[model samples]
Target: MSIMLKEMKAGDQGRVQGFAAGGQAYRRKLLAMGLTPGVEFLVVRVAPMGDPVEVRVRGTSVSLRKDEAATLNVERMP
Candidate 1:
């Protein structure tokens, strides 16, 4: 089953599907950060409070807030 990016924990891997809900600007921001569809990424870490989480994507690490990450639909990979 598909899951929201925010549901994943560190070491989890998944491929981008599409945005769940966001404005054009927000979506553009995600895309600019390399969170485009079909891209594979790893959940690198999550803050103690679980506010902002870091993910490894396209050879770089990007930090995204739970709200923003939640909008990202993902197909978890084994």
Candidate 2:
């Protein structure tokens, strides 16, 4: 099943399916933040209120806001 990036739990791994955000700038920012398609990512943590989630990708830990993370579509890894 596909899910929003923010909904993923810690230790979950997935491949980026696509981004739902509009405009090139938002897409670019997401890409720079390591949300590119085909890349695998692991959810590291979710803040207490769940507004921001941390993910490990490209050997780095990146934090994403709930709204921004929602734009990313991902499928769970087998």
Candidate 3:
């Protein structure tokens, strides 16, 4: 099953499925950040205010805004 990226907690592992309905430019931006479909990522941290969520992707850490993370559809890994 797929869930919004923002809903995932730290230490969770998941694969990027795709993006939710939104802007093409935003999609392109995310893609450039290595969030392409089928890519796996590990949730590293979530701020106390829950504004920025950090994840390890392609061997690098990326911080995404809450709304930006929400736009990603991801499937939890076992």
Candidate 4:
């Protein structure tokens, strides 16, 4: 069960599965920010309107816009 990263709510835990259809440059940008495949991350917070989502990965918090997050595929942890 993979879902878009933007669909995850605050406190959700998941691992990066891959990415949705998008540009390679965009994907590479995310990879450089530590969102590579198989990386486990926790959703730290979501804005009231859900524009910016904060996730903790590799011991650091990264904020992503909704559009940016939508390109990521993640599988929630049990």
lDDT of the candidates, in the order given: 0.89, 0.84, 0.92, 0.92
Off by over 4 Å in 3: none
* TM-score of each model, in listed order: 0.91, 0.87, 0.94, 0.94
Error of 2 at 11 (Å): 1.0
Backbone clashes for every candidate come to: 0, 0, 0, 0
Per-residue C-alpha lDDT of model 3 across residues 1-78, encoded as one tens digit per residue = 989998889999999999998746578889999999999999999998887999999999999998788889999998
Alpha-carbon shift of residue 33 in model 4 (angstroms): 0.4
Q: Write one digit per residue (lDDT tens) for candidate 4, span 1-78.
A: 999988889989999999888646578889999999999999999999998999999999999988879889999997
lDDT of 2 by residue, 1-78 (tens): 778887778888999998875635467888988779889988899998887899899999989888778788899897
- The local lDDT score (0 to 100) that residue 29 gets in candidate 1 is 88
Q: Global CA lDDT of candidate 4, please?
A: 0.92
Residue pairs clashing, model 3 = none
Backbone clash tally for model 1? 0
